[model samples]
Target: MEIEMIIACDDGEVKKLGYGKTVISCLSYREVWPEKIKIGIVHTDGLDATSILSYLIKVLGNNKKSLVMFDSITIAGFNVISLPGIEKLTGFPSIVIYNYKPSIKNLLNALRPHFIDSKIRELAINQIKSYEKIESKKGILYIVNRGVNKEDAIEIINSYQFYSRIPEPLRLSHIITSQISKIINPYAN
Candidate 1:
């Protein structure tokens, strides 16, 4: 069976600069460690869905068959990206994987205070509501997907798990983002 290309995204710790921001890293893979890596910055607790999507589009230019994976929908401190929006824009299946099920109530509580606009908060809540729980060899994973069935998503995820529950592309992206963030913001914890 031929392995489809996988592009996975993950963010590092937020740096406490003006309004707070973090490094977003994405790595592409196909039965290998990584074929390409891209990085971007996004504001913490900001409405950065468009920014995240734009970054992914750039990374996945002309690559229609690749699967896009996210460590979480909410990255860079509540900067939520829409899986459906990504799928529509990039013409690729998208998935958000979580080691544990996300708490909608807690997410709502956190967003309510930060985002005054009801539409923005509602969008985030709706995205969280779409997650479906699935069991893998590693453990349970909560996921939300677009342009792909749950079984295919699970199979793709399982194929990428070698070191941990997190997919290899996402795991590598996380490590790259963390090290880059430390270099960029030495004082950030």
Candidate 2:
């Protein structure tokens, strides 16, 4: 059977030094382990959707049969990605997987006080509202998908998950970003 290319992306914490850019890491895998890895930096609360799309395009190159996954839609503080934008730009399906069900009220409360950008808040709200809850062997997972049906997304997610509810590519990308964050900002608590 031909293995599907799963490209999982996650972002590190905002760096304490410099302009507080966050490291975005993508791990591409066909099976249990990653075949390729790519990393990029984006300014905290900046236009991360554009940056992420560019980074994904660079990583994807000519590979069109890939499925993109994100740990969450909101990355590097309030920098949120547009799911439909990613799907259209890459010509591939994209899914955002969450271990726990997301709270829209909490998100709204967080976004209302600090950000004046209504566009950002709107995008975030729209993305979170699209999530569908799926019950798996591991546990319940909340996911938002574009260009892929919920059944196929759940199948893909289930096949990749071995030790945890989170898929391998996402798990690895998260670990990689977290470690890179510490290395980049040694003094960050």
Candidate 3:
């Protein structure tokens, strides 16, 4: 199955970018390994759903019988990406919003004595949690074909938690992304 994911780097901070990279790596790993799936990625600076959705339609080139796997849907992000008449065109796009926050206090307690680190962790957790719960308030609607459903989508996303915070697919994608960057920046001696 073809899996397309729209990823947004909400905050332009380095930490947020790093997390975005990890997410890409995990996506790549999942795409390359296993039965070998087709993965598409769209990255945006601001969470503009309309723009994102427009871009997706442009990239997809007529979305008929296509399966989309969304990592999240922030209103802003959703606004940027929601396409007009997209549901009618695209078939069964299963959305997989990774929901599950471990809590800020818990994270700080586990890390210990690192205020900066703690705060960064908190922000990341909050962003992800918000995407899963708050951002999805509008809810996602897709026409399902065979082998597609909300439960299936959730299961696929849940499978990634077994390994690390970043899913295997995105983790691997991040590695590839970094490698490409390194090709230009190279390494410091």
TM-score of each: 0.88, 0.90, 0.35
Candidate 3's C-alpha runs over 4 A off are 1-80, 83-149, 159-162, 184-189
> Across residues 1-189, which tens digit of lDDT does each residue of candidate 2 receive?
133688888887665446667777777887676787777777677667555755664465456478888988788777788777776677777889999998887887888888789556567567788889999779999999888888888899999898899988899889998888778765533
- Model 2 collision count: 0
Off by over 4 Å in 2: 1-3, 186-189
For this target, which candidate reaches the highest lDDT against the unseen true structure?
A: 2
lDDT by residue (tens digit), candidate 3, 26-86 = 1212223522222223332233333434344334434343344333332211122232233
TM-score pick, better of 1 and 3: 1
* Model 3 residue 163 lDDT score: 55
* TM-score, cand. 3: 0.35
The C-alpha local distance difference test score for the whole of candidate 1 amounts to 0.75
Error of 3 at 119 (Å): 28
Residue pairs whose backbone atoms clash in candidate 2: none
Candidate 2 weakest ten by summed lDDT: 53-62
Worst 10 residues of 1 by lDDT: 56-65
Q: Would you give me the overall lDDT of model 3? A: 0.34
**Sort by TM-score, top down from the best:** 2, 1, 3
> What alpha-carbon RMSD in Å does predicted model 1 have with respect to the real structure?
2.5
Q: Which ten residues in a row have the lowest lDDT in candidate 3?
A: 7-16
Error of 1 at 147 (Å): 1.1
